[model samples]
Target: MHIHKKLVSLITLSLVLLNTTACSQRIGALNDTLKLAFIGDKDVKLSTQQVNDIPYASIYAQIGDMSQVFIVLVFAEPKVSLTQVPTTLSTELKWLSADKGMIVTVNGRLVRTHNNPTGDLVAVESTEPDPIMLGLQLASTPKTWTRIIDWQPGYHFGYRATSYFNLVGQEKILINDIPTQALHYSETVLVDDLNIQYQNEFWLTPETGNVIKSRQKIAPNLPFIDISLLKPFAS
Candidate 1:
């Protein structure tokens, strides 16, 4: 009974080609099964002296498909020593509207309550969970990948350079231990130079027709620290 309840709590869904990671079946033998990938988190060190590498956390998710959402969380922990004062580790939630207008009731509150000019973020339900899991439900959905059209480059869409806004075929990444191809497109949300961008790597799963992995920089604009796929929250 306890095990069954645990299973009930788990959010079940398929992943699109994906976030910190994606879950998909292989081509032939494993094409019909749903493979789940859970990544863990790493420590982050923030510094004001670095060029663009700002303080950030690694990312991990539990991607899902269909009528799902991309839940993401952030964290930063220091591993050097017990004395290495760690940065305030947490997830800065950036919930988006299903449409392009506004996220009506995010976590229950009106979009205007949490949306601000610079950063008027409001806590929905703050708890230390897996950032990747938060995103998995949405990541599993092929829609998640398609939402970013620039990434559809025949094979796979991802980051292949230092700055995705202008370059490609340079930055490389590993997915499930294999080399994959990627595209680049850095968007400036705020100002031109003061924009946000990332270095990304994507892996597509033909089995599920969704993305499998997405390794991105913490910040696409300012080179902050990076977050890789690790694990997900107890859905």
Candidate 2:
């Protein structure tokens, strides 16, 4: 299931909704692709209405130039979904695409990926707790950490990377027309061995610190994947 190489800058998409009427209309228009999503269409889209109408929790996922709505199908250890969202802090989420591609995340961080377009992320590991698991604590100040990552297609393994995080302050955010103030944080990751550097961002709820939205890169060259919780499970 290789997606089109054409990229839709996730940064630009971050500004897609601004808690306004126009934003709602735009969202509805974007999700008009739902009719085609089931057929494995590329660049698929989803609406908050679609999420609400569904019985299961859902997520809006985008990789490369394709986007789709995935739902929770299995809720257990390492919660699984046929493409989806995360429910709580320090939780592992496994999302499966229409064609059976899998993306797994821990604490809202990309941990592994399989059957991706360009390649796959074999795994990401760290001896210490990932800063994200700390949730709201990470927002108090800037911090840094390190981790080792492995990838497939080229047998790349054991590449270490350092990540620096800085709080970008609280801001008004709207999801599914519900308004809330969320903490924004910026993350920069550098892998000196591969001469690779990438940026990731997260928006966490002020209270529970659950990541409601994020833009993350799985490997050095793989395009960033965007995941946004459209419907969350009860805590």
Most lDDT-accurate candidate: 2
Task: Please give the CA lDDT of all the candidate structures.
Answer: 0.24, 0.64
lDDT of 1 by residue, 125-177 (tens): 22222222223223332212111111111232232221212222333454323
The Cα RMSD of model 2 versus the native structure comes to: 10.2
TM-score of 1: 0.23
Candidate 2 lDDT tens digits, 1-235: 2333111222122232222123344444433333335435445555567657644445667776665545332232444332222332345666544455667766567888877876899977666556777664544533787888888788799998899988888888777667877889889999998788899989988787788888888788778888877777543
Report lDDT (Cα) of residue 130, candidate 2.
67
Model 2: residue 150 alpha-carbon error in angstroms: 0.5
Q: In model 2, which runs have C-alpha deviations exceeding 4 angstroms?
A: 1-36, 40-42, 68-75, 78-90, 136-142
- Candidate 2 has an lDDT of 0.64
By summed lDDT, the worst window of 10 consecutive residues in model 1 runs over: 144-153
